[model samples]
Target: MKIGLFFGSFNPIHVGHLIIANHLVEHSDLDKVWFVVTPHNPFKKKSTLLDNYQRLEMVYRATKDYDKLSASDIEFNLPQPNYTINTLVHLEEKFPDYEFSLIMGEDNLKSFHKWKNNELIIENHEIFTYPRLSEGQVETQFDGHTKIHHVKAPIIELSSTFIRKSIKAGKNVKPMLPEHVWEYLSEMNFYK
Candidate 1:
């Protein structure tokens, strides 16, 4: 199977995420897109994130109805401060028959050069980048790179941070989240 790894914290999975994943799977050659819930992102503060399992549960709920989309806790057990290269290597070791690629937004592509062992990652895997309304130019090296593909998915401006703040301020952010995820968040009183 050709899988596209969409890695994120998924602080609380939202509709925007589902849309992007759905677009990638349905519009691209990827067989499925896995939401690799990160346990700890080296770039993000851990305190700002919900418990790993809680975030993963929200992802599970959000993706449950989509056959082509699924949640993965692949990075949960990996060493802390995990990098993409590490996860890619580990996943390849475990799923030898499957070809794994990356799904990222154009914003991330601008800073892709800073990622650990980025050269190795580009050499080994394909990158599927979607458009984003973010600042900064993509590295000149990536222009027309064979391993990198720019996917014309919708420009979703919604963000998990905005949803979290809205929920905390007693706003109705239900429309921003999946029904099951909204129910879970409401019942658990997360972020409020």
Candidate 2:
């Protein structure tokens, strides 16, 4: 079976995430998508991250109703600085029956070169990209991953950063994530 791996912190899973996963599963050849919850992303700011397990649960809550979507804790058991290459290797070894691909946003294209063993990633795996707005500029650059292509999901500007900022500012972020995820975040005081 062919599966798409959507890797992220998912501090709190949001509607935008759901949209992209839905698009990939419905429109692409992928049979399923696993939301690989990274315990620590090499490129992200660690200070702003929520607890790994908490974030994992939020992703679980958000995707529970979708049969094609799953939450992965593979990064949690792996070493720190959760690199995608290592995770991909592990998943391949663990699930040899499954062929894995990547899901990402197009704006982060330039940084793909900085990803550990990224050349292997581009050469071996298929990548599905979505457009993202960065610094008031809409960047759809594909970088050099010719294997990478844009998905046709509805444009969703929602972001985890935006949701986190709203939570820290004492604003209601319930509308950004699914109802179950909102409940989990509220009950756990995740962002605060």
Best candidate, lDDT-wise?
Answer: 1
Task: Give the residue spans of candidate 2 off by over 4 A.
Answer: 41-47, 135-146
Candidate 1 lDDT, 117-150, residue by residue in tens: 9999999999999887774455556889999988
lDDT of 2 by residue, 1-192 (tens): 999999888977899999899888999989999999978655676787888888898899889999999999988988876678999999999999999999987766667778899889888899987766553333434444478777766778898998988998999887788999998888877777
Candidate 2 global TM-score: 0.88
| Per-model TM-score versus the true fold | 0.95, 0.88
Q: What are the runs in model 1 whose C-alpha is more than 4 Å off?
A: 41-45, 136-139
Report how far residue 84 has shifted in candidate 1, in Å.
0.7
Quantify all predictions' global Cα lDDT against the true fold.
0.91, 0.84
Cα-based lDDT at residue 76, candidate 1? 88
Clash count, one per candidate: 0, 0
Positional deviation of residue 69's Cα in model 2 after best superposition, in angstroms: 0.4
